[model samples]
Target chain A: MDTRERLIESTRELLWERGYVGTSPKAIQARSGAGQGSMYHHFHGKPDLALAAISRSAEELRDRAEAAFTSSGTVSERVAAYLRREREALKGCPVGRLTQDPDVMADPDLRAPIEETFAWLTGRLAGLLAEGRTSGELHAGLDPAATATALVAVLQGGYVLARAAGSAEVYAQAVDGALGLLACHARQEPSRPA
Target chain B: MDTRERLIESTRELLWERGYVGTSPKAIQARSGAGQGSMYHHFHGKPDLALAAISRSAEELRDRAEAAFTSSGTVSERVAAYLRREREALKGCPVGRLTQDPDVMADPDLRAPIEETFAWLTGRLAGLLAEGRTSGELHAGLDPAATATALVAVLQGGYVLARAAGSAEVYAQAVDGALGLLACHARQEPSRPA
Candidate 1:
C-alpha cells in the first residue's frame, strides 16, 4: 500500500487502541513506517489524518450494518443477527469509542462523521422496523423510530459493560436480554382458512 | 473543602471531561489548586488520585440509583423515573466514560471501581425487576437478570448516541424507546368485582 493508505490504516488502529488524545503523530509514524515528511506529504497533520481514518471507520460501520439489515431474514431475525454478529467486544467499537475522546468530540469537523454514522444507522434500522410493522410481523404498538434508537443503544452499551467487566459474556447477556424483550413484540400469526 | 477533598473533586471533573489518558498530574494539581509538594504528600501519584476520584464517583452513582429505585412507586414507575432523571447527557456518565479509557482499563487497580459499580448497578436493578415479577407487576415471562443488563446498557449506550450527535434529545429518545419496549412487559390489573 502507498504511504497515504498506510497512514490512514495505522491511524485507525492507533485510534482504536489509544483514542485521539493518547494517540500521537509520532506513534502513527512508527506504526505505519512512514516518516514525518511522508505523513505531511499525505495529510496536513494528525487532525487531517484522523478525519480520514474516522471517516473510513464510520463508512465501514455503516456498510456492516447495512449488510446485516439487508440480509435475508425476517425483521426479528435480522435484528438478532446484527446483535449477535462477531465483534471484538473487549476492544470496544472503533467508531463508538471515538465518542469518548474529548479532542474528537470538541471539533465539529472531526465529529461530523460520528454523528452522521449513527444517524444513518438509526434511520436505516427504523425503516426496516417500519417495514416489519407493515408486514404484520411486528406488533402494531412497537414504535419504529423509538425502538430503533433503543436497539442501537443496547448494542453500544453492551460494549461498555463488557469492557468494564473484561468479559465478553456480559455483552452477550445484554444482547440476549434485548432480544428477549423484542420477542415480546412479535405478532402471533392467525390460522390459515381451511 | 479540605486539600484531599478538593483534589478528588478536581480529578473527578477532569476525568469526566478529558478521560484518564488526557488527565495529567500537573493539570489535576492546577485544577485542585494544590502544589506539587502538597499533591505528592497527599497521594502516591496520578493513579492513586484517579482511583480515589473513581471510587467517589462510583459511590455517588450507586447512591443516586438507589434513591431512584427506592422511591415510592411500582417497578415500572421507578424504572421510568430512573431513565427520566435529569443529567448532563452530552457530558456523558462519569463512571461509564472511564470504560473507554485505555490507561484506566489496562490497570487492574484503576479498573476495579468501574467493574464493581456496574456489577452493583445490574445486581440492584435485577433485584427490583425480580420483585416486580413476583408481585405480578411485570409479566412472568420477563427475565430479570437479562432485562437489568439491557436496561443499564441502554442508558450507557444512550450517552454514546447523545455524545455522537451532540444532542441530549438523542439520549432522551433512546431512553424513551427502552421504556416503551419495557412497558410491553407490564402486567394488567384484574377486573374489579361489582
Candidate 2:
C-alpha cells in the first residue's frame, strides 16, 4: 500500500488496540514506517489520520452487514447468518469499540463514522425485517425497527460479554438466544408435514 | 469518606471516564485530594488501587442488576424492567466498559471482578428465564441460558450504541424489541379475558 493507505491502516490498528487517548502520533509514525515529515505530508495530524481510518473501518463494517442483510434467506435466516458470522469476539467490533474511547466520542468528526455505521446497519436490518413481515414470515406483532435495533444491540453486547469472560461461548449463547426469540415468531408452513 | 475510600472513588470515576491506560497515579492523587505518599501507603500502586475501584464498581453493578432480576413480575416484565432502568447511557457500564481496556483485560487480577460480575449477571438472568418456563410464563422452547445471555448482551450493547450515536432513543428501541420478542411467545391463559 501507499504511504497514505499505510498511515490510515496503522492508525486503525492502533486505535482499535489502544483507543484514541492511548494511541500516540509517534506510535502511528513508527507503526506505519512513515517518518514525521512523511506523516505530516500525508495528513494534518493524528485526528485527521484517525478520521480516515475510522471512516474506512466504518464503511467496511457496513458493507459486511449489508452483505449479510441482503443475502438469500428468510429474515431470521439472514439475521442468524449475520449474528453467527465468525468474529474475533475477544477483539470486539472494530467500529463499536470506538465508543469506548473518550476522545473519539468527544470529537464530532471522530464520532461520525461510528454513529453513521450503526445507523446504516439498524436501518438495513429494519428493512429486512419489514420484508419478512410483508411476506408473512414473521409474527404480525413484531416491530421491524425495534426488533432490528435489538438484533444489533445483542451482537454488539455479545462481544462485551465474551471479552469480559475471556471466552467466546457467551457470545454464541447470546446469538443463539436472540435467534431463538426470532424463531419463536416464525409463521408455520401451511402444508408442511410434522 | 476515608483517604482510601476517596482514592477508590476517584479511581472509579477516572477509569470509567478515561480507562486504565489513560489514567495516571498523579491524576488520581490530584482528583482524590490524596497525597502521593498516602496513595502508595493505601495501595501498592495504580493497578492495586484500580483493582479496588473495579471490585467496588462490580459489586455495585451486581447489586443493581440483582434488584431487577429478582423483582416480583412475569419473566418478560422483569427483563423489561432491567432493560428500562434509568442509566447514563453515554457513560457506558462501569464493568462492561473495562472489557475494552487492554491493560485491564491483560491482567487476570484486574480482569477478575469484571469477569465475575458478567458471569453473575448472565447466570441470574438465566435462572429467571428458567423460572418463567417452569411457571408457564414463557414458551417451553425458550432456552433460559441462551436467552439470558442475549438479555445481558442487549443492555451492554445498548450502551455502546447510545454512546456511539450520542442518543438514548436507540437504546430504548433495542430494549423494546427484545421485550416484544419475549412477549410474542407468552403462554395464553385459558381464563384470561381477551
Candidate 3:
C-alpha cells in the first residue's frame, strides 16, 4: 500500500521475471510507480531493497514448504505434495532462480536469504525423512540427509528441464521420476492379521 | 585460434560467467581481443555470435557426458560416472544456465542448442537405462524415460543448490542421493552353483 511495500513487491516480481542483472532500479521505480526520492528514502539503494525483497521471498518459501510438510499424510506423501504443488514451471523457482544471478550470488548480503532458504528446506526434509525411517514408513537403511538433498534437487532441477524445453510436461516427468525414486524406499504396509 | 574462433570462445566464457543479459558486445570484444569490425564481420552481432558459442558448448557438454556414459562399466556405474564427473558446480551448466536467461529462451535460435543438448542427454540416459533393464541389471519395472528425467534434474538442480550454498557439497549430496535411489533398483546378481 505504502511506497516501501510497493517498491519491495515490484523488485520481487522483476527479479523473478528478469533476474538481478536484468532488473534495474529504474525499472523497479517504474513498476512501483514510486519516485526516485521515495525509493532512496525507503532503502539505501538497489542492493538494500533487493535484500529486503529476497528475505521476504525466502520466508514465504519456507512457510509454503512448512505447510506441505505438516499436511496430514505419510512422509513421502507430504513430499509428493510439496513436489506436486503447482508452480510456474517455466517461470522457475523465485528463490532458486536467484542462484543463477551472478550479482545475487556475489554479495553475501544478497546471497544469504537464498542460501538459508535451501539449507532450511533440506534440513526440514531430512528431519521428516528421519522420522519416516524411525516409524518404519521408509526403509531402515535410507539416509535421511542424502535423500533430502535429492528431493530438493528434483524440484530445482525440474525447473531447469521444463524451462529449457519450453514445456511443463518435462517438469512433471521429472517430478514423477523423483517420486518413483522415493517409492523405491517405501516400506510395505504391515500385514493384516488373518 | 582465428578471429572467428576467438570470438566464439570469448562469448561462451562471458555467457557462462555473466549470462546473456549481463554479457555485451563490448565485453566480448575485450575478452576475445577482437575489434568491433572483426566481430561484426564474422557474425551478425551478439545473438549470432552467442548462437555459435552455445552450439560449441553444447557439443563439448555432450562429449564430456559421453565420456562418462561410454566408460567401461555396468549401467549404474556408467550413470554414476556421469553424475560424479567433476565440474565447476558454482558456475552452473553452460547450457542449462541459459534457460534462465529470458533473452536466450525468447530467441528460438539461441534456445535451440540448449534445448537440443538436454533432450539428447535425457534420451541418451534413457537408452542406457532401458538397456540395463533388458540385461536385468536394473529393476524390470523401472521406467527408463522417467528415470532419465530424474538424472538430468539432479545434475541441473544440484548446480542450483551448490551455487546457492556456495559449496559443491550440496551438489555431491544430491548426486549421491539420486544414485542411492538408483541402487535400490539394482537386480540381484544371479547366484553361482557350488
Tell me the tens digit of each residue's lDDT in model 2 across A139-168. Answer: 677788888899999999999999999999
lDDT of 1 by residue, B1-194 (tens): 99999999999999999999999999999999999999999999999999999999999999999999999899998988888888899999999999999999999999999999999999999999999999999888888989999999999999999999999999999988888788878777321111
Give residue A174's lDDT in candidate 2 (0 to 100): 91
Position B79, candidate 1: lDDT:
88
TM-score for candidate 2 (chain B): 0.95
lDDT of 1 at B169: 96
- The residue pairs found clashing in candidate 3 are none
Per-candidate DockQ vs. reference: 0.52, 0.61, 0.52
lDDT, candidate 3, residue B176?
85
| Models ranked on lDDT | 1, 3, 2
Residue A56 miss distance in model 1 (angstroms) = 0.8
lDDT of 3 by residue, A1-194 (tens): 99899999999999999999999999999999999999999999999999999999999999999999999999888988999998889999999999999998999999999999999999999999999989999888788888899889988999999999999999999988888877877777322112
lDDT of each: 0.92, 0.88, 0.91
Best by DockQ: 2
Considering just chain B, what TM-score does every model have? 0.96, 0.95, 0.96
State how far residue B49 of model 1 sits from its true place (Å): 0.4
Clashing pairs in 1: none
Model 3, A137: alpha-carbon shift in Å? 1.0
